[model samples]
Target: MHTHHQLIAEKSVIDTIVLSLPFILIITIYLTAVFISNKKYQRWPFYRIIFFIVGILCTAAALIGPIAESAHTNFQAHMVMHLLLGMLGPLLISLSAPMTLVLRNLSIKHARMLSKLLKSAYVQFICHPITAAILNIGGLWVLYTTDLFSMMHSSILVYTVVHLHIILAGYVFTISMIYIDPTPHRTSFYLRACILVIAMAGHNILSKWIYANPPAGVGKADAELGGMMMYYAGDAIDLVIVVILCYQFFKGNSYWTKKAHSLS
Candidate 1:
């Protein structure tokens, strides 16, 4: 019993240190980039810097501190962590336009190379709305339905990989749906809107499934609460995405229409 407690303690310490490293690194790099970029070119948007910081805090809140510790055994806490890590964090970070900031900071040659990479076939494929949806929503379905949830709790490596996937998949999914950054391969607003609806439906369905059939180790009560949170909260964030996409679509159309009228 003593040995087990000691092992748990050791793991907790390790998790704290390991998890903190990334957030610290991200903040440092981001601030440095912003500073250098502002000095060289037009000052970077102050609000975007705040967005990036808040996004980092949201992700950090999910990964570190008491909430993260509770998440291992508490399904409700885990769901909250999921919302922060995968949805809200990604949304705010996407709004920050970090890639655009980076492009502005980089030398012309490097920026061109980065832009070229963005235009590459692999980038285009992964950034497609359909593919992003599969990676994001499909992955959640697999995790909650299979033994993966239990395995993630048991194994540190699995936990790390799952969290990384959640963050990256969510970010990719958001960017795929909305054009906050310089998209080299653009899709029509109609297609993106359709894909967003399908993806959100998949998410809603998965939450309902979790409520009906709890994950391996999670209890029914916890599952119900988490499912509800996932449903309503997820919808709220998704609604924001919908509103932004619609606004941008109509705004762009308006500009084009006026341009056409002037030409005529």
Candidate 2:
């Protein structure tokens, strides 16, 4: 017979697997599509596959493991989850170039339809750097400032919604700021850089505010640690974005300069 502790551990493992099933399924589908596309066409970059796997793992770590379980009672744990789910996970996923893969996989008709939808006013508006920054940073402000943080722990539905919003908002913000894939709505590099700086400031300011005024139920010590994590960890991730944006901008400019010289 299994020992009591062993049985409880097995049950916990089963529960975690059940909770993570949807994410696993989504990852599986994405890999399947990539595999099919690569077999039919040119090979996909190995780096993209690594990025997608790491991104999904980061999300899974935040959502289904000890970190997630501890987050309900520990403010620090929750903040770590926020960093993983909102910043690092999105950055990696966006870098994976999922949209490019999807476009490549689709038939011409479907690709054209998708292209049209991408250029639609609604998509254009939401994908704008300004709009994306507002939703991403604004959502964080609301969650940390209001009682939403405390409430999320109590309601599964609310928790799920908030997590989904964080991931999507982060993805939108990253993609808007950095051209990982073809963007129907393009803003100048300077404009996106300015917006990115402002968003970073907003995020850091909110972390400091949290440090001073802990959320409804969070303790001062835990809040301070969480705040530090948010400020530093967030900056680390944002730094990668900045570097990538600058690299792409300079590279594109150089390419055009060469073309212009050749024409001359």
Root-mean-square deviation of candidate 2: 1.3
Cα lDDT tens digits for candidate 1, 1-264: 569889988898898888889888998999999989878888888898898999999999998988888999999999999999999999999999999988988899999999999999999999999899999999999999999999999999999999999999999999999999999888999899999999999999999999999998889999999999999999999999999999999999999999999999
Candidate 1 regions exceeding 4 Å error are 1-18
Candidate 2 structure lDDT: 0.94
All predictions: root-mean-square deviation over Cα?
A: 2.9, 1.3
Tell me the spans in candidate 2 whose CA falls farther than 4 Å from its real position.
Answer: 1-7
lDDT of 1 at 101: 87
Error of 2 at 85 (Å): 0.3
**For each candidate, what is the lDDT?**
0.94, 0.94
